[model samples]
Target chain A: MLSKKAQYAFRALAHLVEHYDSGPVLIAEIAKKKRIPLKFLESILLELKKNNILESKKGKGGGYFLKKDPSQTYIATVIRIVDGPISLLPCVSLYFYQRCKNCNEKHCGLHDIMKSVRDATLNILEKRTLKDLI
Target chain B: MLSKKAQYAFRALAHLVEHYDSGPVLIAEIAKKKRIPLKFLESILLELKKNNILESKKGKGGGYFLKKDPSQTYIATVIRIVDGPISLLPCVSLYFYQRCKNCNEKHCGLHDIMKSVRDATLNILEKRTLKDLI
Candidate 1:
């Protein structure tokens, strides 16, 4: 359901959530904790900061911190921000719906089956926030 | 939730299921019908047969056939055989239960959330047989 990017992003964010509202969270610390590449994590945090999921400062005593407590940030939100959709197949996806190449959108035989999968996926991913993971 | 190999395997199998009980299913036919590469599908089918989901014969008038109906074969089985586990995270995985690197395996905090996701994914995938997709 999630991509490598989304997985990496969630792992990083969960680390932030663990230290939520206390102080700035360092990119290096998160990268080391999550086994993510430092440069790659730097970019991921920048994107999260852009999306207001995290707030950051560049100087000493300055690092990224959650804009909200981890409990408030849903895993679905992180996934959508990082991966565009919780479902890889657009035909079954709610957040990123698209027609299958050779099928009718309204009466697709695949619609029901795929929808069930999509809903199940969302049900699990949507309920869990960063707090749940940590 | 799905790997590239699983997705491709499912696609190829669905194509085979479509033509079930009709005649011998050519590897090329299933590959082309499903838009999968011929060579990659060859290996996928071989594995499927190794699991007895399919039966094959070499030479002319021989290709492949479902050992049983596509409806009898669960997507979960295919996935497990091909990709080991549906869950990417080891903490909540059903088939491949490895301990998380930083957590106590017995009472891991990540367990419930990951389990829910795993269950949801499995519920959807398990209900879907190749016949459903076809």
Candidate 2:
């Protein structure tokens, strides 16, 4: 399942994508528009900014904006930023691989099936851009 | 992410699938082999039995066994029994559908992508049986 943070991040991004050409949009404006908690959204947007997915301005009429075009950004990147691996099992993860204790990946049935599930999920997430989502 | 309960459930089922024709396997033995906490494995096996994925025999030389042939049991069914919806977004879930708050399913981009994700996951999970995993 997608974490709440990831869901909120997507909603916030969708809002920004809608106002991409309108210059910086305020955090408060985004929180209100997306119905995300202000404080929670503050950290989420800050994280996105730190990751280069978004940028911000300061002072009067200051707010945030996407660093790249929505078409260039992907939902998979947003999910990874908020929620770690997309794989259900750590052993099957490509970006965040971890060996499952007491199990041999080569011979394990669960590992094989999980790898397939991960591949399937990645196919959709990698191909679909934020523009598609927006 | 898969819940701890779901993971343990799979581990337990994998162990049982390994010993499918070897009579009832002890919950204690499964817990020991899979490195799952004994108490946790107890409840997990009980739940699987309740779902008809497993059958338990009490007393001398008794333990647990798969209710159906391992080849007939799918990972998707076990996951649903332990973790509810397979869909990332409740709105896209077939068995556990729920409306996303403040969103219109027909027009939401997240909904579209999440539905694809759910379908992709279901495809691999539903087609692959416990036999495949073992």
TM-score of chain A of 2: 0.96
lDDT of 2 by residue, B21-125 (tens): 999999999999889999988998999899999998999999999999998988899989998888887789999888899688889999999999998999999
Clashes of 1: 1
Error of 2 at A59 (Å): 0.7
lDDT per residue, candidate 2, A9-114, as tens digits?
8898889989989999999998998899999999999999999899999999899998998889877888888898889888988888888886788898888988
> All candidates' TM-scores?
0.81, 0.96
Chain A: TM-score in each candidate? 0.88, 0.96
TM-score of predicted model 1?
0.81
TM-score of 2: 0.96
- Runs in model 2 lying further than 4 Å from the true structure: none
- Output DockQ, candidate 1: 0.39
